[model samples]
Target: MKIHDIPGFPNPLRVRVVLAAKGLLDKVDFVPVDLPGAEHKRPPFLAINPTGTVPVLELDDGTYISECTAITEYLDNLDGNPILTGKTALEKAMVHMMQKRAESELIDAIGIYFHHATPGLGEALQPYKHPEWEGRTYWGEMHREKALAGMHYFDSVLRKQPYIAGDFFSMADATVLGGLLFAFYAQIPVPSALTALLEWKERVDQLPAVIQASA
Candidate 1:
């Protein structure tokens, strides 16, 4: 398998962490996509993925897979352990539920906020800002409020449970982690009152898979 993405960014980092968790990092070759250069947005890459996104997984069988959720589903089911997703029917339901919430309420909202505020998280991330999106301010402030609400929601969820979905660390947890990373880059501060969320982040940061991926 080949992972076409630039390392260190939020969405790409999500899939890379999943690979590390599944012990599949060593098996997959990483092809860097020039996100700043608009390589992924052009016809050459668009032919591979119409969505024109990063962290696309190209299989050995000559098939391309996009989206973190779908890529994660493929990886989790591959080894049959499926610990990062879910095993039982109810577990899958719970994981998916939280996963969607994590994406919509947190990651996706932050992406909109940051992209509109400036291209590529602006000065937060070097070499990601495109010339077109520079100095362009849209409805980013509105999404900033939305992202803050998302942080509060997740904090409340963490206060009630050991993990985002339930007892086990599922894909939802990874999505939240990625969102938080993006929030940090976007300079969206997580309030000091959200101690539970901070504690959860600290705990997950120590996990072997997360540590490996971050490294």
Candidate 2:
């Protein structure tokens, strides 16, 4: 399989972390897309993913899979012994639930703040964004607030358990890690009072897979 992605970018890094965790990092080829050049919006890349997103997984038989969650699912199950996603029915449901929350409340929220609130990639990509109605700064601030709320929610969850989805480090934890990455780039500060979440992040950073992926 060939993974098309821009290294260090949040979503792509999410996939990379999963690959590292599954011990499949060396098994696949990494194709770097010129995100700064808006190459993802062009034809050749768009053909692989109509959404024009990075981190597309191209299978050996010519199948293309987009979306971080979907790609993670495929990779996790590829060995027939799922780890990052989950195994049992309840585990699957809980992990997925937290994953969605992580995406919507944190990662995706940070994305909105970055692209809409701030000067995103550049003027070259501006045409793809929606016209500012309430004002870009106003909308950006709103998204920032949402991301902060997400952090608090996760902090509360971590206070109760060691991981996002019960005891194990699942996809939900990966999603939160990705969200924190995005938050760093977006310059969104985590609340100082969310000590549990902060400590949880330190623990995640120590994982060999995370360290490898971040490297």
Candidate 3:
């Protein structure tokens, strides 16, 4: 399989973490896409993923899979043991629920703040963004506020449990880790009172899979 992604990007980093966790990093080829150059928006790359997004998985059979969560699902299930995602029905539902929350509340929120409020990747990608509205900065600020709320929410959850969904490390944790990565880049500060969430980040940073993925 060929993984097309731009290094250091949040979504692509999410996929890389999944691959590392599943011990499948060595099995796939990493194809770097030039994001700064807007190569992903061009024809040759758009053919692989019409969305023009990075971190697309191209299967050996010539199937292209986009979306970080979907790609993680495929990798987590490939070995049949299902570690990152859950195995049982209840576990599956819970994990999926938390994963989606992580994406929407934290990851996507920070992403919007980065793209809309900030300069984003570059002027090259600006045309692809939404038509600039009069209140665009206000909208981006709202998203930043949402991301902060998400941080507090997760911190509250972590105070009662070790992981996002429960006791075990799961894909939800991976999504939060990716969110935190983006938050750091976007200069969104985590609440100083959220000790649990800050400690959780420290623990996740020490994970072998996360280390491998970052490497």
Candidate 3 per-residue lDDT over residues 1-215, each given as its tens digit: 99999878788888898999899989999999999788999999999899998889999999999988899899999978899889899889989999999999999999889888888888888877674676777888899999999999999999999999888889899999989999999999898999999999999889999899999
The Cα local distance difference test for each model comes to 0.88, 0.92, 0.91
Cα shift from native, residue 14, model 2 (Å): 0.7
Count of backbone clashes, every candidate in sequence: 0, 0, 0
Report the alpha-carbon TM-score of model 2 versus the true structure. 0.96
Candidate 1: regions farther than 4 A off? 119-138
Q: On a 0 to 100 scale, what is the lDDT of residue 196 in model 3?
A: 100
Span of ten consecutive residues with least summed lDDT in model 2 = 125-134
How do all models score by TM-score? 0.92, 0.96, 0.97
| Model 2 bad stretches (over 4 Å) | 131-134
Off by over 4 Å in 3: none
* 1 versus 3: better TM-score goes to: 3
lDDT tens readout by residue for model 1, 39-153: 8878989999998788899999999999999999999999778988899999999999999999999999888788777456334333433435534455666778888999999
